[model samples]
Target: MKKRLDLAAFRDGILSGSRVVLGQAITLVESALDSDQELAAELIQSLMSHTGRAIRIGITGVPGVGKSTFIEAFGKMLLEKEKKVAVLAIDPSSQLTKGSILGDKTRMESLASDKRAFIRPSASGGTLGGVSGKTSEAMLLCEAAGFDVILVETVGVGQSETAVKNMVDYFLLLMLAGAGDELQGIKKGIMEMADALVIHKADGENLPSAKKAKASYQNALHLFPSSPKDWSPKVSLASSLSGLGLEETWREVLRYEYQMKESGFWESNRARQRINWLDEQIHYLLGQAFLRDSKVKQTMDHEMENVRTGILNPGTLAKKLVSLFLSTERPQ
Candidate 1:
């Protein structure tokens, strides 16, 4: 086993922006061990005052939407403006093997090597939202490390977009022009959640179509109900290769931040997100406890087989398991 750091060591290392310690601290939080979790919680509590300063932006879209490329360009741009950036890229894990490529660092070579930027790629671990379960914690750690911008790049499939939206101050959806029926290429719900729609790869011969797609998206956005914050989502074309619209995209983010802060929605939204996080944690803890119960573990396979064979109802088995779990003796 790797030697564990005391709470003070973890806390001080993270606050002092020690990259090695920061990585180890993130690993500690992501660990499944009970001792590590206890320490991780203490570290987070100690650093609470230092977090929530960075602008959290989640970028996601369909496969091949150039998410990594866009983030690299955007991160580099932020660095140019003398801003510190941290990227939390979530990679999908294979269901059969439970292994992940964790290739974001490889994909974003330049940005990963930069001193002003930090990139941490995590495996989704079959999480439904294209994000790892510990992503929010990692974001807080990054914020505490003095990153001005936190970019969360999701797997861009299924419910990943919605999952990311809840944790971020801004949601950026990247789309490819001429991929299919412009509006039909992605779900309406995902589009509605975006604070900005970026038509990526808008360079060379694709610029015109990207521009056309921009207009289409702009019109479509107008038809949706107005946002509660009274801020309209902006659609723009960007090319990661030629650096088109990168600055404009940052400007929109800043403008949205200003407008939302002015209207008091920024803090309110973050408050709501915290509550949601609490609820999710409750559910996760309950589930973990249920699975770890000795009695439940002893009967789970039998009950599952019975259910598979239609000998027991799933709901009945679930209730039975819960009862067994709750009835199990606990050490007070």
Candidate 2:
């Protein structure tokens, strides 16, 4: 028989900064089981006052952009300054098997081993946003547990990458130097969303190219309008191998944060994020409920068959399906 988790004990343990209890709380919130979800909601509600204290940053880049390496070095630097850091690393999951590489723990060796840092690498689980489905809840849990800095790293920049950007206080796009392509594999949309861009691999041999890339990016950013925060996005150079530019990158983030707070953009941005999260969750839960309705499932399959055989048009079938679902659904 499974033993019940003591909610009060867990709450106190997390508030007291017990890593073990914090890990358990994170795991509880990440679970998709119905029973666990009730407890998770309770846990989050209990810890609500303790959250939103951490500086949240979302980092993303292409495969070879050295995101993990940079995060390792950057997280270590923060830890050295007596700040507790939490890394919510999102790994790509397999479409066929839903399996994940789950290698961030191994990739971020130094930070993973550091007592001041907590690293949780989650599978994307085929989520549309380029992040784990429960990342926001997990982040709240981490913040409640006393993490001063929370770094969210996405699987890679793609259509769904904006999901992470919407959730974080700052969105950082890392790029490789000398890609030669004018856009360097970064889409204009994603590039515009970045609060800052760091050209990685700015070491000995790559120094010249990194500097050139910085100049090009700076010019391109000039063509774009200032961010809603009223601050112009800055581009910098970084080298995980040489540790050059890391401090500068951190400084840029701090500076941007300071400006946002001074302009009241930070509070408004967080408020907007909360509304977005609520809307997204409502859609997800409604979809799940629709799928779980046996009557709706049967009606949908029947409608799909009619559409497949050309007996019914898609628009008519969709309307009929929605009516059926609404009729059959139980009121909450």
Query: For each candidate, what TM-score against the reference?
Result: 0.92, 0.92
Regions of candidate 2 where Cα sits further than 4 Å from its true position: 1-4, 91-101, 123-126, 129-133, 181-184, 305-311, 329-332
Error of 1 at 196 (Å): 0.2
What is candidate 2's lDDT per residue for 252-316, written digit by digit as tens? 88898888899899989999999998887778777877777888788787678778989889899
Residue-level lDDT for 317 in candidate 2: 74
Candidate No. with top lDDT: 1
Error of 1 at 167 (Å): 0.6
Per-prediction tally of clashes: 1, 0
Residue-wise lDDT of candidate 1 within 89-184, one digit each (tens)? 555443432222244337778987888888876644644432345888889998888889999887636666666788899999899999564656
Where is model 1 poorest over a 10-residue stretch in terms of lDDT?
A: 96-105
Alpha-carbon lDDT, every model: 0.83, 0.80
Q: Listing every candidate in turn, what is its Cα RMSD in Å to the true structure after a full C-alpha superposition?
A: 2.4, 2.5
Residue 122 of model 2, lDDT score: 67
